[model samples]
Target: MQMPLLIAADWLLVVCAEQLAYWLRRDGLPIAVPTFHIPDVYLYLIVPAIFLVFLHESRMKFRAFPLWKMTQAVFHAVLWSVLAIIMLMYFGHVAQVVSRLFVAMTGVFAFLFLIAGRTALAALLDRYHLFEVPVLLVGGGDEADALLSTLAAHGGCGMHCIGLVTDARVPQKAAARCAVLGHLADLERVIGETGIQNVLVTASGADSDEQVRLVRRIQPLVENVVLVPDLAGLPVANSEIEGILEGRHIFLRFRNNLARRKNLVFKRLFDIVLCLLGAPLVLPVCLAIALAIKHDDGGPVFFAHRRVGQGGKEFPCYKFRTMVTDGDRILADYLAAHPEARKDWENDFKLKDDPRVTKIGAFLRKTSLDELPQVWNVLKGDMSLVGPRPIIRAEIPKYGEHFADFCLVPPGITGMWQVNGRSDTTYEGRVRMDSWYVRNWSVWIDLACLVRTFAVVLRREGAY
Candidate 1:
């Protein structure tokens, strides 16, 4: 049902985009006063068919996919379809009649339409549980709880946990979320009774041989058996598995993306282009904020703090001043008076309520307008638009071994931590996120982070 519905939605959206593109090229933004040559029926049919074929090959289905993964898949499908259309036009000698602008417009419209359509479809399905795959969890440990939380966080993933089957001691919190159906020995009976189609196993404590045997034994009883690997806090984006000796020996390989010179250059170019294009908007807002800060208090508008950049280089990271001149003194006095506040500051380096922030500064911080000045750092090659968060020297020791990975890429104004939960995330969590971003950095991930940053800022989530 999910697959069929998705196919229908995708076809409809592609057709609509073609018509919209035709209108835009012929009527909305006409290139010349020449008569328009309407696209042939076969051309329209073939283009959509190509898209469907490519999307099918990409495994567009009811499953869990992060935003970047979905975007990458959809973008490739539309791109290939557009290229095929161009080749057909040239080979059929219709390139003169079929406007190149029309073809270009169609590809742009199709990409947007397909992404929007799929996102809406997922939301609708999640809201009604229309195509959720009910599965039984086979563990009751921390890994199992984390998987459950992930399912809850990504409602559109289409996975639903009915119950659990475990032999180990189940945590009280895990039991509260989902009941234990039966022990490992009665797993077959529980599945038969419940008629579950999928089983998700977390073989965290099991040896390799036992895990393999357990999976082989369960293969005959379930439609799908998903084995969760115990590789938390590792880079998965650029990792691949290799099989040798007739699939007897398998090895996982992880690539350090930043180690390649081309990737580093691409990232720099991405940052510069985005910063330049965004300057017109950013400059005006910065000016307004500067005036507001000056009106609130006669202090310097811009603040530059020392932060570690790429290659362990020290640079001045700029931001709009959001605190009083005597911020340190005020913090010391306040922490002395309020002993509980000291713990929060030590843990996260942030305070929900602080005495040093001015009225205008608080609003700037909440909206993240204070970080607008960092665009200069981006243009200067000291920072990126999306990478790890900049850390001060005092916080270097906290990252420990992960600090090497953190310095691989320049710091960013917004990154994984900012989008996840700016001030709400713990310092250790921030370090882990930074490490992950450094390892799994890609153009798609950066674009997705930029998109989510808007929603996070607008919602004022985890802001101080």
Candidate 2:
């Protein structure tokens, strides 16, 4: 197994991190560097050893390979590593023997070096197609095909599809890229021969009884088994196990920790701090935009429309007006004449070539300059800096089942929907994305979304 190799790499990375930290501290702050020295550097070996213990204890090292998950593991590992160093110093009666700055620098370096090493190793493995887990699928359908394609598309996923075990003699196109090893009855024999460690069951059109039997049989044989929950359509946004009965079943909920007061406190604090820092950078551009709007259209520079906000409360969502004063009238006449335009409006509530937009408005929309005013919305707490897009009262039913989840947090000026496909995404996709944002909200995710928004805007994708 590559498990031992990964562990070994981690240990070496930790050592390199500590050495680099010591060198940096010595060079960068020579005056601040401790003049005293410990009896032996060998005593510091406990840091890496502590990392291994915490990695196993926290089980952070054992999760499935996702970049985000790996990042979290690295952070947690480094955190525990620091704690272990403190404990070691305390217990060994050498608390003052080591420099505080050394410990802090080592912890930071460990995080950076470990992540860099893991990333480099994964890239090498992916490029050379080495150290990949061989696996086979046991299904045939769109969902089955999509899963196979997804794995094939992402090399870092670490699974290579050797073949598939289908219900038929020949596999479909989804599994056609591989091979039809055999039917469900041949699963055990095929796995035994091929040494397949992972089995992803996505057998569509097969009888439920056959699926149950296959699961029961395959569970004991395979090292890893993943059920796709095909019966339910992608398991609602932010859905997680609420509870479970002993040896029976589990319950799921669409909500998470949105009610945590501390989380909200941090979220609000972040918004306020960010808004203050960002205001100066955008102030000049914003003033120029207001002047342009006034010069071009002789109308209001800022637009404020009632939008459904947190808890179904109405708040004026502000924007630099990008449409003509008679925008509504223009849209009505256009939609009445063009079924295509109306259809698009009914679906995504947007027009690709909206006639109601002024020339400056089009430019502002494409460049996303029009959203500058919504920073005020974020400042006022009516919206977040990153969240679901603000909706109108009429669009409430469009959120449907996800309304409560959507309302759990304030809408954001820039969010998952904006950074993703924006108006190009299907209405259902947008709603589901909002639900996902609510479910998966985190400080890192919010920051990531904000960063991605810049790139998306530059690309001008899904801009109307």
Candidate 3:
């Protein structure tokens, strides 16, 4: 509950960054001498107020930031720094003594230091469990178990589930992580004893009326109360908080994939720009690869296979020919000879020592040069630059319920699975990975995966 210290730290860190920036910029990066003097008053006074206001605008409450997330805090820091620069531009002109270079330098340092400070503080809090908010879990059965698991995994999210208030039918001994402090009737007593600030309602067995009653009773007792809806089993994308019946009953709507054209338009523009930029570098290499493939097997240079794309429509996902001619026949013969290879192929749809792969193909696959041609697929609107791996019709059932979610977006040549572990990942494991990626889709995540793909390829950790 001693969270005001974090707020104070936030302010002080920005001021420190500004001072550091002043010295660095005045003396260059080497810190020699002040060529341009920064207005001391702005660095010490006006800028701190500006930062607090921007942070307030970002809806930063005096709460533990474990739930707020470091990425969001860093993002807020950037936003405040930009706004601070704009404010200085206006106010500095009136003050008659502010250096533009100094202001720019201050902004840059403020951004970095704010992030670094918050990260260090968050880590300290996590280490000491300072941000841990004692909470009571309401309900029982599978939902309760899932919530318990989630809370345990995300302890740094400020949720320390101190006690449980489950139904009598659900054995209290079953929940080994936290003690069953009391039953539903003794909820207030449990809260008082546990010093609970948050209450999580996961009423799996309870009906709507019981849920409403529980929520009404627990509303004033805790600072925050969360309801876990029945939709947890399904992969939902965007969710929203809403109130019904004149604000008495509130619940979260776990939204299904709402494919917005604007987002797709953004993705398309990103794909096109990246492709055009890399075309020159990749084209020559692609030509050489084609020639080698042709020379190796006297077969087609490119291999285009019909793979499932967005909306369950099939598209020709292109790649350089990596397998020998009559690949299927060769694979059957190979599998017949080696039981271990057959088992490996059955498990992950990949073979570490595939007899069908040409030497050139093996090298290309290892380095992920095989996917260079799929940039064409990205440009032609068939696949994304980063998404779920392109699945053929035979692989649809492998996704199960995940199939619908997977098809909601275009398949990718490189994705969460490809980056995390390509051929080494099991088919079921990939389904889970791709499902999570789709459910938590963001432009930042896509960019991160694309960047990590290079590292993964270079390391050749999972690639065959």
* Top candidate when judged by TM-score against the true structure: 1
Q: All candidates' TM-scores?
A: 0.93, 0.72, 0.70
Give the alpha-carbon lDDT of every model. 0.85, 0.78, 0.75
- Of 1 and 3, the candidate ranking higher by lDDT: 1
User: For residue 159, what is the lDDT in candidate 3?
Assistant: 57
**What are the C-alpha RMSDs, in order, of all predicted structures?**
2.2, 5.3, 5.9
Instruction: Give per-residue CA lDDT, model 1, range 1-464, as digits (tens).
Output: 78888888888899899888777766787364246665566446777888899877867553577777787898888888889888887887654576788888888999888877887788778777778889889866888877777777677379778999988878777787788998988988998999988988988788899778778878898899999988998888878989998998888999888889999999899888888898888888888998988888899999999999998999999999999999999999999999999998887677899999989889988999999999999999899999898988877889999999987889999999999988888888899999999889888899889988988899999988
Clashes of each: 0, 0, 0
Residue-wise C-alpha lDDT for candidate 3, range 348-406, written one tens digit per residue: 67788888888999999889898889989988999888888888788787789999878
TM-score quality measure for candidate 3 = 0.70
As for TM-score, the candidate ahead, 1 or 2, is 1
What's model 3's lDDT at 235? 39
Order the candidates by lDDT, highest first.
1, 2, 3
Leading candidate by lDDT: 1
For model 2, the local distance difference test gives 0.78
Writing each residue's lDDT as its tens digit, candidate 2 over 1-464 gives 56777788888888887777666665657555555343345434666788777765655433235444566667887897798787776677663456777788888888878766886777666667777777778877676777876666556366677888876544356655778788877889998999887888886666768778778889888898876656444435345675565736567675455667888889999999999998889899999999999999699999999998888899998999998998888999999999998998887778889998999999999988898998888888999999888998889888888998888889998888898788888888898888877876667667667766887899999988
